[model samples]
Target: MPRNLPLFIAFRLLFNARYYYPIFAVIQLDYGLTLPQFAILNTIWAVSIVLLEVPSGALADRIGRKRMVVIAAVLMVAEMALLAFVPLGSNSIVFWAWVLNRILSGAAEAAASGADEALAYDSIPKEERETVWPRVLSRLMHLTSITFVFVMLVGAAVYDPELVNRVLDWLGSDLVLAKETVLRFPIYLTLLHAVAAVAVTLSMREPPLETECGGEASLWSGILAAGRWIVHTPAVCGLILGALVHDSVLRLFTVTASEYYRLIGIPVAWFGVIGAVFAGLGLLVPRLAEGLVRTGTPRNNFRIVSLISLVGLAGVSLAIPLWGVVVAMSFRFAFGLLNYFTSHYLNAAVDSRHRATVLSFRGLALNLGFGILTLFYGGLLRVLRDGNPVEGGNDPAYRESLFWMPAIFVVLWIGWWYHQHRRVHEARP
Candidate 1:
């Protein structure tokens, strides 16, 4: 296997996904998205995944893995350009343009998903491929978190949060005055995506494989085969379902933690500190996963870690609002910690041939779950926000940005469902 392929994948994700999210959030703010509205946009991406995911997986295995990735990279660049160049103001035209970009992104994402895995699987010999895939994925995730944490820190540092407040204080200029800075946040983002596209184009490689991998089955067939595999292979399915539950919580909390803190009276400047803390703690996750591996019981360890995650999530949700976010954040580290081991579990599940496709399915599940949750969440926030329009509903604040009333509901709902699922699944005959 070529080492460059792994490096390329990491860089692609780092620049493509990691950087663009924060940028998207800022642009949506400029365009008239409320927190709930952003969730709606996220839901669109989620729904698109549901539509394209299985089909794309078949496309990768049938057509060519590397080709799809290249296409996705190109689409990513176009998407950023659309966001940057599109004129500001609201109306169906502007809103739908952004939505079109997201849908394109979703389709690109679907194509890219299976292709990269197929490419990576093809690059290595069968035995070595499975082991390498997880490590590659983990490194990519670590790079993404590391990159975003720093970007946010820098963005926070340069932009004065009080820009809005000062204008409000002097001009009594309610909001139109503060809009320019929020909109410009995308400029920095567009630049980042440009750099990311270059990195992907320059670095990505398609390695050859020994096995046949999967094939160009019909989209529906691919979907059905995937479903059958899990149904017949319950243990395999159990762990995957466990992972979905585990991952969604991880994404949701990480996405919104900073915003929740800000809302609870933590200052914007201090938000960087919270992010920094998350990045610093993230360093520990790999080591924790390593420790679990050393114990010689990855399966047992993952189950234990899932429970640990539940407790941590439950603790933060129930405690933070009551005690304040600073106190809640104190318990937040557990999610990051559990994530490392979860990665270990994912690595254990399959061999190279289906790595990307199966993993893409997992990605599909996680994203859809998030999108669905966000959709419901948006409704909840509207009820809670009493229908106030958002600065950017289509942005990051929707994901990790928080509303306490809705959050409490999410915490309870997720916790209850996780428990019920865990109970039923674990008792499987």
Candidate 2:
């Protein structure tokens, strides 16, 4: 039941995200903001995360993890509800609302990140966390993928930015009712957030706290100490680096990939179908990763999976069709092979004493990846759009997204493989 909870929540998020995604895209259109404006908003979102990641985790330490998660869940529900109802079409109100939601979400997330990791770490015996962590995340995400795929089909059928106003016109409905109808998807999305918050509150059991000294240290001191600890282990640093790239690629797909599909003339409903196709791969690949782990270290399986994933991603970077995103997701799931592996590295490398501090930086590393990805993608979009990148959505520039992500995958994989090899030799009798 406990393991099933995260998977259920993951699906809920994707289901919810589908509704807001278009809302996010169309709000800019509604407000007379261009693509650049959207990018700027996203940039702000990323910055909020990057700035707050460590501090938020530290807050978790101070106030306790469960409190922060509950708070985060509350913020998510409020934020989504506010977006679904309020008409902020051309005002700073919408922008600031977005910013506030993201910051709060970050704070809430910070509390949970370490706590969740720690919780899962504790669920299994100390020896098993290495093996169990990846499976746990994969299983949850896999369950989420199946849930989201179906939800995507539903979302694609219902919530559409392009035809939303048109449907409203035909129904001859009042604007308020029409808008509320359009926002239904997000309301359900908010419900999912509430559900996740509740789940964490009730179902989650705390991981055994580390005996590490960082628990009592000042925030800055803890953060610096964690950084120092990270670089000392090849597998640990590799895991952190891989997570950043992994998140970047996934967010890029999550934030803008569907819009690109619509631009290419894939039907809106079809977009949801494609969502299933991509996410469906999530269900398949983690099981395969679990199979691979029976024989290899997390690092070894990571190398094998990363190489295959890069190949798949390269196809994604090249294809212009909606199916390309499907292919991209295929590769993306393959990379997940290392999640459990690297999780093991982090768990093993950190003494119980400073676990949350080091783990907070783990969250920080991933957020930094998210920040860099947005800036790069935003700049790339701007460049592709002839210096008016913010002038609303540009269909032609969607393919340009293919260029940046694949190369980064290559560089990170090579670095990770080298480190793994060196570590293996060092451990020899």
Candidate 3:
């Protein structure tokens, strides 16, 4: 594993999240932003990624995945730098800076999405593909979970107002403890993380090209081929679309989770603990999901995972107690493997020559759905909270808006199921 450059790089890259992701909403709120405002910022991020996903992906396919990954790392540094400079309070300058930060972060994410996975996939030895790839991927997930849990806990500890205030007093510093100061601590940590990520990305070697298409293809040609492939392949389209819905809802839920925690009476200080617990649960999910796949099939596994996600969303909508939130969030364990499974399926179905472009299409679909959902969710908050979006997460109207999410998943599930069923029947002699 140590010698596997791609896998090792991925594992190290996961630790680049020194900032506490679970408390991101709280950080925005501390900056004097409202829920709808934060949602809009996230929508902007999603929109940016959606718009760039395919073009960047096709370019990676045309060029090389490793180079794009290095570019993404640089973007990450820029994003963090922007966020770190965002002013203490809500103002035009602060808001726009944060918005720019989101855009940069989104671009970084889009750039790396398909390229990183493709690089890792192509790096593995062909003989060890079936057995070793999943194990390596699983270990990567575990590494991410562990790295995130540790980072979140440490960041949260530093971001804790009471803890920082006490230390400030003990140090006899003239600086008084402030919300902005505490919140900025995590952002500062990200600067170091970004530098490390850039270093790691720079050291990564691109795996040998395995595509049989000979020389590099043009971006337009790759895009055209990818578009046609999606249209022509029913299973690929269904799988990507289904994943789009599932992932979008889950992503929104995640972005707003800290707000939900606050609404349910949990303090910002406890968010890190809760996030760590959720990450721990995530560590167990893929293994459990694989066991289910062994007993059943990937089709059944998808249904079960989707059902569990629906249940989790419903639970989030209704949860009032801290324990309820914890239990509700724990259900995301099922989601840990959904994308890996979907990506595997998509990678298998697409030609290697256009793999990154098609994967980018999947990213574009997911981001587009998420951007639209963010707008709708923000609209719901505006309506339900009487324009006081700060309290929207606690609003019954917000919970009610989420009730429809399960139905969306159901519809996508049925569509995917029908597509798979039809394909199977057509294959019958």
Best candidate according to lDDT: 3
Residue-wise C-alpha lDDT for candidate 2, range 244-329, written one tens digit per residue: 76666656655666566655556654666676666676777666766776667765675576666667667766765555555656
Worst 10 residues of 2 by lDDT: 14-23
RMSD of each: 6.1, 4.6, 3.0
Name the TM-score of candidate 3: 0.89
Residue 375 of model 2: what lDDT?
Answer: 76
Model 3 sits at a Cα RMSD from the real structure of 3.0
Question: Relative to the true structure, how large is the alpha-carbon lDDT of every model?
Answer: 0.58, 0.60, 0.75
Give all TM-scores, in the order shown: 0.76, 0.79, 0.89
Ranking by TM-score: 3, 2, 1
Query: Model 1 compared with the native: what TM-score?
Result: 0.76
Candidate 3: global Cα-lDDT?
0.75
Global CA lDDT computed for model 1:
0.58
